[model samples]
Target: MKKKRSNAWLYFFGALGGVLYGYDTGVISGAILYMKEELGLNAFTEGLVVSSILIGAIFGSGLSGRLTDRFGRRKAIMSAAVLFCIGGLGTALAPSTEYMVAFRIVLGLAVGCSTTIVPLYLSELAPKESRGALSSLNQLMITIGILLSYLINYAFSDAGAWRWMLGLALVPSIGLLIGIFFMPESPRWLLSKGKEEQARAVLSRMRGEKRVEEEAEEIKEAERQEQGGLKELLEPWVRPALIAGLGLAFLQQFIGTNTIIYYAPKTFTNVGFENSAAILGTVGIGTINVLMTLVAIRFIDRIGRKPLLLFGNAGMVISLIVLSLTNIFFGDTIEAAWTTVICLGVFIVVFAVSWGPIVWVMLPELFPLRVRGIGTGVSTLMLHTGNLIVTLSFPILLEKIGISSLFLCYAAIGIAAFLFVFFKVTETKGKSLEEIEQDLKDKHRGSLKTETRTAEQ
Candidate 1:
């Protein structure tokens, strides 16, 4: 019980990174309107403004794992907090859209690093009994950040105060910096670095008197068998796991969650809400997201990852179809208004509960220890690359194809995602890192052995 209580504080600090990520991403949905008006951006330029961060994120996510592996997760996350402060302040004070885009890219880099590093750090630190709940806190904090941004945006909407919305990220970034200062480094990371004594000291505090040596030994064995490098991830034995990680990363974005998230206010405006109402409604969306994410955190372990993913994907598909049909039936004006609002609320709920948390949980665990860092980096790069494509193209797609068609496309992608999860993905609910690694190795050997026997015959 004491150990659980002590670990709770560690998880809390880890979650601060999630808050910055959520705030930075969510703030833009509301800020874009004021930015467009103030900076006089058209659809093309507006897309660039919104997507610049995603572009930067590709680099941040792709590189963060390597940096974390080398410098330790604590230092990587601290670096990310510093980036968030710089990016938030720069974006808030930008004199033009061009400068704003530049600042946003900086913020995006921070978001990318936080998104990758925080989950990895949390998963390593958490006890198996509480890992899901604790790890899910990352997503929970993200929702809180989202909700907070919406509330802030709504409060300042009348004043056209997008600068304040963008600037508010600094508060949490500072909190993250301070909170992480008091937190210990990941024990697993310490063990990887050959500092077994230091690792044991940290784990002892979190694991109590009974299990520290056992846990340390387990960490050491996992590290011993790990083949850490980018090239190793492509070896035949590791290929399947890499593919699974990459597939989840790709499908998470291909399903188009961000299309609605980053552009919710704009979509709401299309449906007929004025700027203030749209911003307020965006807050409502964020609130629902927070509430449902709490629901997910409570049940993710009990209900299991695969079931939640299946349900969420099915829900998203239906919601997107309904959303598209509503736009079709109501025409561009009335239907677009209500349809977007209702559909987005449903979609956010679905995403928050499932893919949002599960993808992060699954990616790091799927790869072997040797290549975990590089594999995660590659997978995260795929995620952000997909993000960049979706974000950069959504506005153009909406304009060219219309909202209904755009939604229809997303619905199709969601269906594909549902099928992929139902068939291809395995459940990793209760397995330890070493157990998961052995399971993969056994499966790999079994496949190879069968192939050899068949060839001999």
Candidate 2:
């Protein structure tokens, strides 16, 4: 008899961790520039400081699967919220280079957990018909967080207030912690724990009383499968999804999106812009990032995942090629500066609409309920690995090869990513998670029978 609650609160607070993820990652792009002088950091240490989070993320994601599975999704998120506060405050107050990198690694742990869990959490809560759009809220929040960080960076750049830029992340961390307590636990998690009555209550509150029985039954049926763990991930039926999820995760980073998110200011300065002008240019890119993600959120459910991936990949390859040409031909001229900004803008627009949102949406959908947490963890682990490699190598590569060669290399990677999506990725629109899992099993079974017939002949 409790009044039905709106799912908006569920989506917002549930995905709020993404804001912290975006802010922490995006703030570093600007903060590192100022802090480099104050902390006496060179390129080697600078890459270490920026990429240290990825190392922590690697471990955090690996651990989060078991943590969320054992403790439940809400508590896992709550734990990450706590880490965000500790890491943000510690990083801001650090005095030495060692202290800063250590604290950033701590922040990375929280980022890793949030990135892996938020999309999974949202996808499990959303109905299959609207799951793509609903889960994309996590990506949308991430873009907002990035834009917020850029704004903070521009505000603080003149004064070189890097500490303030890093510290402001604490504001949203606290908000997420407070809001999570009021939010319902993912009903699927409850069902897995054998609390069917409690699960139904949560479903009723979120989906109204009528839809609870059928959806709860479906989840229950899915759970009846052998409980999944890391071992089950390698089983023939699950391997395809694992390969696709990990592949997308890898390509998503290596295609060079985070280079823009993490090093746009540095990139702009390399072309010709001044410190403040470079930071301002990143703000423009961040704005385009947020706006275009809104476009993805609108069309993702309608257009399906593969098409977005295909279109976005092609656009990225073209933009990066153009960006490389402009930097090579124009060097430090005014024309190069404008062209650099324009190319990056177009790249962000395309990436925001495709890989940016779609990767997160598809990762959770790719796994079955039994292994969803761990599978997503493994996928995100790959994601953070790619991010670490690219983030760490970019500054070094830029110095050694110049921006033109580095970007051109990324464009070639983009072409490879486009081919991977065309050949390997599958459309997941308008399908339930259970349905997707069944389809995987069906295909695996079909392939095995074909091999049997060939052997008999």
Candidate 3:
């Protein structure tokens, strides 16, 4: 018999997919500053270049669902790995603005698919009891990627070595490709394809054979009811699921956290810090992000999702308020600079442990088995759309309205996100996908009755 595989080995490498996605996204954060100088880009042009990847991401996310369904999840990830490799090489070699934009789009496509699929893939592989924490490994890897990129930026920032920053993403991309080779295909996906024995075989590697059999049976029953198409997603019950998933997706982007991730170095320079200080400051924020995400991974299955959302979003509102005040009242003083950093640091930690990781965990669980992939893809499409708008508009907004006003807008959006979570987002911790779906169906039934009564009145 083949040696029983431990999930530890699988998770380490499978999570590398997230690492590549994170590195690609994070590399541009600091590299964009240098790219602007080398390319002679204005604020508008810079926004255009940065936003271009998001456009690809929107489409990539939309397409990844079908790709995974038709080709299998493992193959889909392999395809993304190819894109990451090519995108990294092309981006590093680009000689002009148009080439860079196009290359970044390539990376965006890869990043989009990784972001959408890794958590889903991981969740599908993990047992229900440990699903929350295992899925969070994707987010943890993302923070790691971000921190790695910040370190790379700082290392190269002195010589304006933007190419190296972008090129280095190639390392993880190649590593991810090699690592996926050792992975077993997701048992859930295998079962869906009618390869029951193959699915069982895969599951056996992850757990005891009897447990694998029971779980396979459970997944089969859940999937039996999931025969759905696009229109199925619009059914009264299904619509609520879509709203909950997509709302968080859009709100995650609109909260403007990416503004810090993408433009922190430049933003700090504009505010008051020297180039070295700004880079160091950005790295500092990245450090907080990784550490807090680690803390989150420890407690996610233990603490529950709603509490994290409530706690984090509430703190975000406060942090953004403080950040805005510091910028407006204190201007460019060293004290204000430190204050800005502290507030952002808090926001980073809060979000790292909450919305950042939790949203990815929630997306896959929000839909029924039949439409889960498409539903997730559609939600991710909206997310990238929001990201596009925010990324594209940040520079223009900062120039036209200033940073204080931009952050104020984010603070207001935070209030709306917090309320949405309190009312709409249900806790899914420690629940299997089947259990979550049944609960959704029950809520849908009650909601339908209430609507019928209100309509009669």
Question: How high a TM-score does candidate 1 get?
Answer: 0.97
Order of candidates by lDDT, top first?
A: 2, 3, 1
The 10-residue segment with the lowest total lDDT in model 1 = 331-340
**Candidate 2 pairs with clashing backbones:** none
TM-score of each: 0.97, 0.98, 0.96
RMSD values, in order shown? 1.4, 1.4, 2.0
Lowest summed lDDT across 10 adjacent residues in model 3 is found at 1-10
> How much lDDT does candidate 1 score?
0.86
lDDT tens readout by residue for model 1, 1-457? 8767777788899888988888888888888888887999999988899889988888999899889889899998999999999999999999998899999999989988988888888888887766777788888898899889889988888888999999989999999988888889988888888898888888889878798988888878878876778777887878878888888999898898887778888888777789898888888888898888888888887888889999999999999999888888887676567767888889988998999888888787787766666677788889989988998999999889988899898889988888888887887888877777788889889999999999999
Residue 417's lDDT in candidate 1 = 86
lDDT at residue 196 of model 3 (Cα atoms) = 93
Candidate number with the higher TM-score (1 or 3): 1
Best model number under TM-score: 2
> How well does model 3 score by local distance difference test?
0.87
How far in Å is the alpha carbon of 292 misplaced in model 2?
Answer: 0.7
Superposed Cα deviation of residue 322, candidate 1 (Å): 0.8
